[model samples]
Each structure stands twice: as C-alpha cells, then as structure tokens.
Target chain A: MTMKKIVLMALAACLALGTTGVYASQADDINALRHYFKKKFPTVPFKEFANGSYALSADKRINWESMRDFPPFEDHVAKGEALWNKKFKNGNSFATCLGNDVTKVRNRFPHWNAKDKKVETLEGNIVACQKANGEKPFGLKKGNIAYLSAYIASQANGQKVNVVVPDDKDAQAAYEAGKQFFYAKRGQLNLSCADCHVYSAGMYARGNLLSPVMGHTTHFPVWRGKWAKKKGDGFGTLHRRYGGCNKQVRAKPFKAQGKEYSNMEFFHASMSNGLTIDAPDYRE
Target chain B: MKKMTLKVALLAAMMATSGFAVAMDEDSYRAEHKAATEALNKAKKVGGEWRDSRWKKSTAVKVDGKKMSYLHAAEAYAAKGDYKNAMKYAGIAKFEGEMGYQQAMDQKNAGPRH
Candidate 1:
C-alpha cells in the first residue's frame, strides 16, 4: 500500500475511535467490575452478594435469615398491592400504564429511554403514570410510593437485574455520567460511592458495614429497622438510600429520579446484571 | 520634619491596609460577607455544595440567634456592629466554600481507581 494511503487509513481509524469514548473500554466495564469483586472476595458465591453485609459475615447472615419468616417489609408490600388496584382521579390505575402483571415491572426499569434521550427509572415512570392519569404524584423516597414499589418488586422477586446500555450515543453518555458520579468525590467528607462500596466492601464505616457493589441493585425498596422507626414507614426506594448515603457523606443529594440519579441507577443496575432481584428486603 | 511626617503617614496607611486598624465598619463588613456568600453560591452552582457549608436556619433562639451557622453568626455580629467577629465568621465560610469548589474541580475527571 502507498504511504499516503496508509496514513489516510490510520487517520480514519483514529476518527472512528472518536472523542467522547469508544465502546471498547466501556462495554466490558460492568464485567470487569464483577470480576474485580470476584477476585477480591474469592469465597463469596456470586449469588450471596444479594445478602450484602450478611454475605460477608456469618453472624449477620443468621440474623438476616431469621427475619425471612416475618420480614418487617411485608405489610408495606401489601399496602403497595392495594395502591396498585386503586384508581386514579381519571379512573385509570397503575395497571393502566404498567400492566395487570405488576410482578415483572421491577426488572424492566432503570433503563435507557431512547426516545427521551435519558435514563428512565421505575419510580420516574410511576410518577409519570400518576401525572398522565390526572392525579397527584407520590413522593419518590418513602411513604406510599415506596410501598407500591415494594409490592412491584416483590412481584419481581426472582427476576434478574437486566440493565442495559444500548448502542445509542446519548445512552452511552448517560452511562458515562453515572459512572463518573459513582466515582467522583463530593461534599465536605470528599467521599465517592466507590470509596465504601468498591474499595471498602465488607468493611465497617462507623458501626454499619459497607456493602459491596455486587448485587447491590438486586434488593430494593428496602425496609430498614432504624428507618422504619424514623420515617413513617421504614420501606424506602433505592433512591432514598442514595440520598441518605449522599447526606451521610455531607454532600448535597441530587433529586431522586432526576437525570443525575437515574443515570446513576442505570450504571449501578448494569453492574448488577444477572443478579437476582430480591426486593422488600430487611436491613439494619 | 516633613520626612518624618511622611514616614508616619505611610506607616498609618500600611497599618490600615494590613488589618492592624480597628475592626471593619458596616461597609467593609458588607463586602466581606458578600464575598463569603458568593463563594458559597459558586460551590452550589457546580453541584459541589456540602451539607455542612450551611444549615437550615433553626427557629430556636439559641441557634437562630447566630449560634451554629457561620453565616448566621456573621449576620448577627454585623447587626450588633461586632465587625471583628463578623469578619472572622465570613472568612471561615469563604475558606470552606473555596475548598469545596476546588474539590469539585479536582474531581472533574474522577473515575474508578483500579
């Protein structure tokens, strides 16, 4: 080949590689994340991460398993189921937007909305559905919204977390934004999400153990014993936990289901791809 | 005698500018307080605002009376014409805000360590 032609071809290849990022590095990001944890925790069975701190502690596991019979979140889930059937002012219900089969709705969200050009969350859609039906939207963090989500999650109990990053550029950018947010140090404490979840997994932060990133998204709308006593109902969506964590680090929290957090949900959910969905779970 | 007068005048001006003079007056205190607020706003604009940077203004007489929030204390001091205390609190807020902004910039490209 002529030298000039070879140079032209090389330039073309570089252009194809592009400025924002090529998929080569990002495509395997989730896989590499899982592998890193697998390497760090050789003894943990891949499925056990759903149990979080319990997975790392035998004593904690016993305590967690004991709560399985009469989980504190059960009542909250039933309340959610009732909300599912309750009609809006316009007479439409959650079943109108989400189908009668609510059990499968949990795994379907925190997905890329190609048409909207942003990450769409289950809670966001719930609010949207409420608005579309001419009803006041529920709060995103706790209360009836969390209870309804808990019910939807219970329905999807055994489903796998299936977050995806599609081929679209906006979708990729959203994922990248979330990844940056996850790692970026913020607030007075100057701590990132990865600081505790990735680097210090199974380690104690004050009294509570920092759970790993693995299977983190599998459990959601959790009912915490402490939170149950504080916030009217202890059942809270994952976004509530996100807000709480950001506050704990002394950082100002982004609005739940807003672009910043929804994108974060996209990234973190993808990291937990293939993990079983275990919703309405209990935690200390 | 003229030279001596000039030397004294220069020393007096230096002292004023070097913060060896009496505490700031209302106008000077206003300038300092404004600067602290601006730094805090800048940090907030970049989404790097920390919760500790400012707190909810309490209704209690103790904290609402400029006991906890540095900005609040600065305002209370300024109202009482305690420019020394006002300036000190303003300086603390300014430093913290600038630190928060610098941290945001430093972490612009923050990503996975490994």
Candidate 2:
C-alpha cells in the first residue's frame, strides 16, 4: 500500500480503538477489582471485605465485632418488619407486590427496568410498590425508606449479591454511566470514588480508614455512628452512603434513587456479584 | 537643604501622578467592586453544582487559612474602604470563580469512562 494510504488507515484504526475504551466486560471488572484488593490486602480473607473498614483495621474490627453483637439497627429492623407486614388501606400489603416472597426480594432490586428506561433501586421500588398499592410512597433520604430498606435487606442475609446488567443498549448505557460517575473527578476536592476506594484503600484520611471498593455493595442499610447524633441508630441505604461519600469529597451529591445514583448502584452492585449479602451492617 | 527640597518635590510629583497610591478614587472603587461583583455572580452561577443545599454555600475549602469565596471578601474590603485590596481580591475572586464555573460546566454532562 502507498505510505499515505497506510498512514491514513493507521490513524483511523487508532481513533476507533481509543474511542471504544477496551470494553471490559462486567465479569472482567469484577475479577480485576477482586484481584486488586487481594493484592493490596493479601492477608485479609476475600469474603471479609464485606465487613468494610473492619476487614482491614484491627481496632475497627474489634469495635465492629462488639457493635455487631448488640446490633443497634435491631430496632430499625423491627420497625421495618412491622411496616413490611402492615396492610395498606386497600386490605393489601407490600407482600402482595413481591408475590409474598419477601425473603429473597432484596436480591432482585436495583434491577434494570426496560419500560421505565432506568435503574430501579430497592428503595425506589419499595416506594413504587407502595404508591401502586394505594399507599403513600416512603421518603427517599431516610426515615421510612431507611426502615423499609433495613427490613428488606435483613431478609436476605447470607444470600450472594446477584446484580445483573442486561444486554440491552439502554441497560449498558446506564451501567456505563454509573461506572463513569464512580470514576469521574468532581467537586473542589477533585477526587473520584475510585481515588479513595480503589487507589487509597487502607490509607488514613482525617483519622478515618478508607475501605477497598470491592464488596462495598455487599453490605447495605448500614448503621453509621456518625449519623447517630442527628438520627438515632443512623440507618441508611447504599445510595445514601454514595451521596455522603460525594459530599465528603466536597462534590455536590445527586439525590438518592435519582437517575445518577440508580445507575451508580447498578455498576457498584454488579461488582459484588458473588459476595454474600450482609445488610444492616455497621460502620464508624 | 537641597536634598530635602528634592525629596519634597519628588513626593509632590508622585502624589500628582499616582494620587497617593493608597487612596483609590470613588468612581474607580465602585467600578472595581462592580467587576468583582459580576465575577462573583458567575462563580455563584457555576458553583451551584458543588454547593451544599443544606448549608446553602459553595463547597470550596479554605485556602491559606482563608475561604476562597471572593464575593464576600470583596464586599467586606469595599465596605472598609480598602478599594486597592478590594480590587486585588476581586481579581483573585474572578479568577477562582471563572475556573470553578468552567470546571462545573466541563463535568456536568460528562459520562464516558476514558
């Protein structure tokens, strides 16, 4: 081929390859993230990462073990159970919407909704279910939603995370959007979610231990001590934690269960595919 | 005696040309403050993305032990009749504000993973 034609072809090929982003599969990312954590903290058991900061720091583990023994979220879980079982004014219950199988329902959440063209989080789905059943939707940030999420997640203890991203273009777009949000740098701090969770895991930041990104999705409906002062027991969903992390980095947080967060949850949850669910987890 | 006369003459000449340097003109102060206010407005417009709704303020951290928020500092300096300092701070504020606004715009619609 002529040199001019060869150079033009090479340039076109480079542009196409660069724009396509190597296109790692969900499984590829999951394995790579697990391997990254394994290499980082080889001594810690793979499954123990689900315990969050406790999995790394000895002091945190001791405190977390004691906290887990009493489990301050017990009261919230009980309230959630009560809410779950409570009947709507129409004589139907949330149980009716989930086909009466509440035990495994949490695993099915944050699913891709083809018709709605968005990710449907467990918290959002619960509210949608309530609204559909003639009941008032639970608030998104905390309170009823936290209580409800606590109860639902409690039901699925020991079940492995089974988040899936379907083959649809929209589903792929959403999952990609979420992954982008997780890695994108923003705020005055100019830190991405990956900066701490991926690169700086196990490092101390302002006296707090940073946990690895792997298995972050394994636990949800956390009982955080920081929130205890303002909110008794301080139960919150994964998306709420996402917002808090964004704010911690000085970035403005998107609303919980909004399109941004729902998509982020989709990508984040898929990373914890085989990790056992340990909802109602505790954290400092 | 000649040295003292030259010093006084030079002082008078400096005053005539630069208006004592420290004493900024009223119209100039107003204009400087107005420009700073305009820059502050741009920063505010772009800063909403990083602002904390609960606190209703920019998420910008303190720089050199002082918050980088230029508008308030500019206003305070203007109120104290420190127009020279006000203008200087206003310029800094304008620079930070424009950078902040640009950063917000650049990332607002970005979603690719590259």
Candidate 3:
C-alpha cells in the first residue's frame, strides 16, 4: 500500500476506536471496573470485596472477622427494626410506605425514576415516605434515618446488588454525570475518586489503607469506629461516608441524597452489580 | 517582645515585596473580591471549584473565634477596613479559583485507567 493510504487507514482506525471508547455503555464500564480490579489483585476473589479494605489485607480481614463475633452494629439493627415497625400518626409505617417486603428495598434503590427524570435513593424515598405520612423527615446523615437504613439494609444482606442505568437519554445522562464525578479531579488535592480507589487501591494514605472501588456500594450505613464521638451510635450512611471523603480531599461535599450523590450512588452501586449486599458493615 | 517585632517586620517586608503596598482602600478591596468571586464562579461552572480555604476543621487558623475560608476572611477583613489583609486573602482565593479551573480542564477526559 502507498504511505498516504497506510496513514489514512491508521487515522480512520484510531478515530473509530476513540468514538467507541466515548460511547461505551454502562455495562461496558462495569466490565472495565471488574477487569481492572481482577488484573490489579489476581489472587483476591471478587465476592470477598464486599468487605471493603479488608479484601486487600489479610490482617485487616482477621480483625474485621473478630469484630463480627459481637458485631457492634447488631444493636443498631434492633433499633432500626423498632423504627421500621413504628407507625406514623396516619397509621402508616416504613414497612407500609416502602412495602411489606423489606428484602426488596436495598435492591431497588439508586434507581432512575422515570417519572421524576432523576435518580431516587432509598434515603430519598424515606424522606418522601415520611412527608406522605404525617411526620417530619429525618436528617440525611445520621440519627433515625441512618439507623433505619442500617436496619433495612440488614434485611437485604445476601441479595445481589442490581443498580441499573436505563437506556433512556436522561437516565444515561445522569449516569454519565456520576461517572464523570468519579473520574474527574476535584478539590485542592486535584484528586478524583478514581485516583485513590481505582488507581491507588490497596495503597496507604497516612495510616489508612485505601480500598478498591469494586464492590464499594455493597455496604451501607456502616458502624464506623470514628463516629462513636459524633453519632450516638457509631453508625453512618454511605452518603455520610461520601461527605467525609469529599471533605478529606478538601472539596465541598454535595448534600446527602442530592443530585450529585444520588447520581454517584447509581454509578457506584452498579460497579458492584453481582456482589451481595453487606450492609451495616463495620469500618474503621 | 523582640520575637514578635521580628515576626511583624518579616511580614511587613514580605507584604511590601509581594505588590501589596498599593492603595488598599474599600474600593481596591472590593475590586479584588469581585475578581475572586468571578474566578470562583468560572471554576464552579465546570464542576472544578476548590474549597475557598483549607477546611476550618483542618487548620488552626481562625478569625473571630471561628476558622473561615480565604474568601470569608477577605470579607471579614474588608468589613473591619483591614484592606491590605483583605486584598491578600482575596488574591489567594483568586489563585485557588484559577488553579481549580486549570485542574478541571486537564482532567476533562479523565476515566478508567485500564
């Protein structure tokens, strides 16, 4: 072939690959996430990632497992159950508002609500559910709502995560926004979520080990040890953790259940599509 | 007392050398704050806005018993007619805004590493 022809062919091929990369589907992104972690930690089984940072460290896993014997979060679940069963003045309860099957709650969240043309999180629904009844909504971070989340999550403990990004344009856009937030650099550190979790997974920053992004969303309403001073119990929701991360990076945290976090939850949860839920998990 | 005098002398010398010796009346401070606000808005447009200062929870620096952002510090200083300090903080905030915008532009195409 002529040199001009060869060059033109190479250019066309490059353009084709670039365009394909740009338009890769959400499923494609999830597959890429799986492949990246698999390559990074070949010995680690994918299912074990439900344990967060423990998946990468044998010592941490041993400690985490010991904690599970008398799980600090067990009492919070009982409290959550109490709250879940408590009826509103209008004779409606979380069980009634959300439905009798609590098993389905965690699996259904971080979903694209077509009616609202926005992402709806479990916390967002709880807020709406409370308003629908004759009660004030709970705060997003901690207190009753987080306790309730911990309880509801405990019910779906073994259910596989199945967050979806629908084929609709707006749904795709929301997912894209979240994907962008994950990868795009933010804050004074000029670090993206991917920078630490994806690129530097298993590495330590100061005294803490950074966990991989894979299966990050399987856990929620964690009983974090550090929260003992602030939270009545050491419990916090995923959004609360998200805020803490943002603050650590010197970025302004988006409100819990706000567009930024809800959309992020959608993308973040989908990354762990097949991983079983491990809610109210303990974390340092 | 000698150490305090030396520290004050060093600060004055640094400020004079950093082009902060110019007129720092309310009008100048306002002009600087306006520029910082505009830069911050621009950075925010691309979702690249940085914290106005290190988090108050992060640092020992405080203003009126509360740690404030560089932007807020500028405002507070201006409110007290400490125009030089106001201008200085406003400049730092403006620097952060521009840096944040540049960082966003650089990472506009950031995605999966693999």
Best by DockQ: 1
Can you give the DockQ of every candidate in the order shown? 0.53, 0.18, 0.45
lDDT of 3 by residue, B1-114 (tens): 999999999998998865554443767888888999888888877767776543334342466887788888888888887888888988888888888888888887777767
Candidate 3 ranges beyond 4 A from true positions: A1-22, B1-24, B54-60
Q: Return the lDDT, model 3, position A80.
A: 87
Which parts of model 1 have CA positions greater than 4 angstroms off?
A1-21, A24-26, B1-25, B55-69, B76-84
Computed on alpha carbons, the lDDT of every model, listed in order, comes to 0.82, 0.76, 0.84
Q: What is the lDDT of residue A106 in candidate 3?
A: 80
Per-residue error for B82 in candidate 1, Å, reads 4.7
- For candidate 3, give the docking quality class from DockQ: acceptable
Clashes of 1: 1
Q: Write the per-residue lDDT of candidate 2 for residues A13-96, one digit (tens) a residue.
A: 987887644555677778788887888889999888787788888888899999989998898989999998899999988888
Candidate 2 ranges with C-alpha deviation above 4 Å: A1-22, B1-48, B52-97, B100-114
- What is the iRMSD of the candidate numbered 2? 4.1
Q: C-alpha displacement of B42 in model 1, angstroms? A: 1.6
Ranking by lDDT: 3, 1, 2
DockQ of 1: 0.53
Better of 1 and 3 by DockQ: 1
Candidate 3 lDDT over A123-235, as tens digits, reads: 89998999988799999998888889989988999999988788788998888888888888888887889999999999999978899888888888888878886747788
Please state the Cα-based DockQ of model 2 relative to the true two-chain complex. 0.18
